[model samples]
Target: MVQSALWDFLRGQFTRLPYPETTFTDQVVIVTGSNVGLGFEAAKHCTRLNAAKVILAVRNLDKGNAAKRAIEEATGRRGGVVEVWPLDLSSYESVKAFAQRAMRLPRLDVLLENAGIAGPPYRLAEDNESTITVNVVSTFLLGLLLLPKLRETGQRYNNTPRLPHLVIVSSGVHYFTKLPEQSAPEGKILATLNDKATANMGDRYNVSKLLEVLFTRELAARSPLPSQAGNARGKGGVIINYLNPGLCHSELARNAGLGLKFMKFLLARSTEVGSRTLVHAASAGEETHGQYLSDCKVSRVSPLVSNDTEKHGGKLHTRIWDEIVRKLEAIQPGIMQNL
Candidate 1:
């Protein structure tokens, strides 16, 4: 397995695959953290595919506008094909505000939750660890908050035979995480993660991603969408999935040190190549709901995440989801009602 993983990692370095020829024609798409790196490339692809409105949700409007202009210049489809919206993943208020604006739109066909932080100095946001807050908490907050709009779009287009999509950006590094034992304790996981001495900040990002995968699975199971079991084409309501971009050459790791930078320079896939996975996941059908995707296909997850009929059952997955919902509810009262 180690050798196979190494081979896959090496192949990712040379991957130059183009975005698939899927047209978003008239669809409204939103990409978070789109000011630079993979998010920016993905937004560019969305415009080139003809999305009517591609919102670049970022923390800084200035950088967002610059990215929008660059994408417009590259795609040559100007005149508001791309719009900048303010979103700070570390702020609950910001997420709520962004979702409010999104609900005002007549249609929301796709939402790409691409914004994330890799490694940063220990910090807290909204009473939780910074990485967990931004990567897992606020990410889901905005996603769940926007569900109403996505569901509305699905209903409006139900007869048209299409479902709105929600795509979460995850990482294969999740497989490397051995979740903190305290992370399993009720009402204590976030607090435990916040404790700098006990928390392995190096692996905290990976743990947050593992939480994302578990959340995706639970969310799909709880979704009103019909199951993809018997039907191959998949019954549609709102399709949700997480994807691994594989060691992409992006600014996410800019702060990591010279050694890591040298390795990335030698082996990382370009942001454009990595963004193709995001575009593919966003355009995929319901069959991919709750699955981890790599290289544009439904890929196997780590044994730690694999579903088993007996051993431990689904308790671990459920525990993580319950904790997440509890934390989110504390941030926004009655937020569970939205889900």
Candidate 2:
């Protein structure tokens, strides 16, 4: 296992994957956390590919404007090709408000749930661990909230040949997480994670990513699109997938200590390179739906993630999904109705 990890790390550091050349002409795309780092680079790539509108969903309006200006200047695509939208993932209200505003868009072709945090000290937001709340709960809330719009876009252009994409930014670190044991009872897993005494801050982010993987798989399984005549399964109405950017140099680790900083400097890929994986995943075909992508391909995930049949009977994924929906419903009443 250690050797496998080392090989993955080395491949991420040295692999020169090509940036995707998928065109986004006339497409409207939204990338969260777009003010800097991987998000910013992805937004830039979208503009260069000629996306009609690229919404920079960010926490800070000032920084968002700066990023917009920089992208416009770099791509020479002015006249509001890139718009700045405020989005604070830590707050449920903020996410709701942003989703409401997004409903006004003429079309939303791609929704990239890219904003996330890491390595901060243990903190609670809205009665849940900060990482869990932002990365898993709020991220899905926003994704669920936007699903109607994505589905609408697909239906509106069903004959025009289009596939609306929802891409979640996950990490390879999820492979390291082991969620609560199956014998620990049904709802205790989330409770254990929320408990301050038992929760491990260092591992919380990894666990959050694990939740994302499970959530994506369960969501795909439960929400398959209607099949055509004589076909076993139809194309997914909204293609949702998760990807790992592979230890990129970014602001995600700014709060970490010196040891992490030095290690990052030595092993991390540039944000530009890492963002390519995001673009590629966003542009990929239905074969990638509900899959965990790495190094710009559909790679093998960890056994813990892949082996749901072990001991727990295959219900682990369903139980976790139910818990997430319950928690999300508490925050955004009737939100699941949209999904």
lDDT of each: 0.85, 0.85
lDDT of 1 by residue, 177-268 (tens): 77865444676676788887777887888898988998888897788464444542323478889999988889888778788788888888
Deviation (Å) of 13 in candidate 1 = 4.0
Model 1 segments beyond 4 Å from truth?
1-4, 15-18, 159-161, 182-184, 227-236, 307-310
TM-score of decoy 2 = 0.94
Candidate 2, residues 1-339, lDDT tens digits: the string is 747866886777788878869988888999999999999999999999989999999999999999999999999999989999999999999999999999999988899999998875888887688898899999999999998898788777665345788999998888776765334678767777888887788788888988888888887666565452233332338788899999889999888889878988888899999999999887887778778888998987777766784656657788788889999899889988986
Off by over 4 Å in 2: 159-161, 180-184, 225-236, 309-312
